[model samples]
Target: MLRAGQAREDIKVVSFDVDGTLVSPGFVDCVWLQGIPKAYAEKEGLSFEQAFEYVKSEYDKIGEHRIEWYNIDYWLRKFDLDIPYERLFKKYEDEIMIYEEVESVLAVLEEEGYELILSSNAANEFIEFQIEPIKRFFSHVFSATSDFGEVKKTNGFFARVCEILDVKPQAVVHTGDHWVFDFLNPRKIGITAYYLDRARKRNVTDEVRKEDDEFVISDLSELLDDPDC
Candidate 1:
């Protein structure tokens, strides 16, 4: 766990991982499978879970870009379902909601003069859908699918963010939910890190968990109490 201390005066920028970090309503993964695919699968006489699994299996073999394309249009054709892409997107939009304390935390950070950037693994459309609600908070928003061609967990992603922000790794603090992808990897590259264990959803091994610089409160409101900020 990270001890309480003042933030470095030289730090000028902060980057965050989206999805489980900021606005986690918990429906993204399950909805893509059960809600979106299942609706189509049922129309085609296939079991919903089976349809979901089959599409996922196909995605795993073809790689991430293929999955991005799948997000655009392939699922309907692949499953022989008649749903339009726009309607499928709406289902996800309606179900999406922000996390408990995101606004308050962001407000505190913005008032501190830190330039905020959103680095996420979701597709461009998904990011667009989310930005509508929180557009005022970030200085820049980037999606791995649209901006980098790979997720933040991969090489070149963090480097790209550093390059774009024109800041060094040590000068920025990264916060996110994924233990390996968000915390460990960014720390390995010299960036400071915080783990947002919102809802305590992830169970990581002690060795890996120890690497985090801080375990921030689950609610964004707690950020107001952060002595460092």
Candidate 2:
């Protein structure tokens, strides 16, 4: 359903969440699940399995609600690893995996004249490294945690993005996999938001079906199916 360059004037900007939206969870999983634990194992002289257990426990203590939980440098320093954080980035550079439909979707939206932006909770360095191939498609990249000192779920982050972009909440469209952070949070401020549940594992679409059936999509291409998006 890709269209010609005739973007709707009302929808000025289209924002994307990085992980699990444009990019697959593979690279991040490699970073947190494999790379960190492997480094911890080497530093502690422990088995990888044992290091994984301890690292996961420490991560849980901080929890996803905290900014440190998403920071690679913080974790590297906290674990007192012998290796540098940049090493992990270099080693796992090959692991970055963007979703298949991401380029096509971005191209269509860009061709339609919608200003494309990436607003993520991920660290800025990680975001920059991962999106190298598609970076040209986006005019701005805002890291909520790295830039705003707030997570994506916070209204402050979204509000700050709107202020910087000089657009109202209603003029934007956002899509991501997280139900609360991507869907509810943006909608709270009147942004047209879609929950991109690629696996169809979430019940968000059903919950919103009565009002807006397109609230949740199982594929990025589905965004093109909606005229407003």
For 112-186, candidate 1 gives per-residue lDDT tens digits of 788888878877666667657777888888777777777445536777888888898777777777777777777
The residue-by-residue lDDT of candidate 2 on 1-229, one tens digit each, is: 3322224457889999998998887888888899999999998899999999999999999998888987888898899986777788788888888989999889998998889999899989889989999999999999988898885556677888999999999788888988788988888888888888888886654567656655677888877856776
Cα lDDT computed for each candidate against the true fold? 0.67, 0.84
User: TM-scores across all candidates?
Assistant: 0.78, 0.90
Q: Number of clashes in every candidate structure? A: 0, 0
Q: TM-score of predicted model 2?
A: 0.90
Cα error of candidate 2 at position 51, Å = 1.2
Give per-residue lDDT, candidate 1, residue 226: 44
- Scored by lDDT, the top model is 2
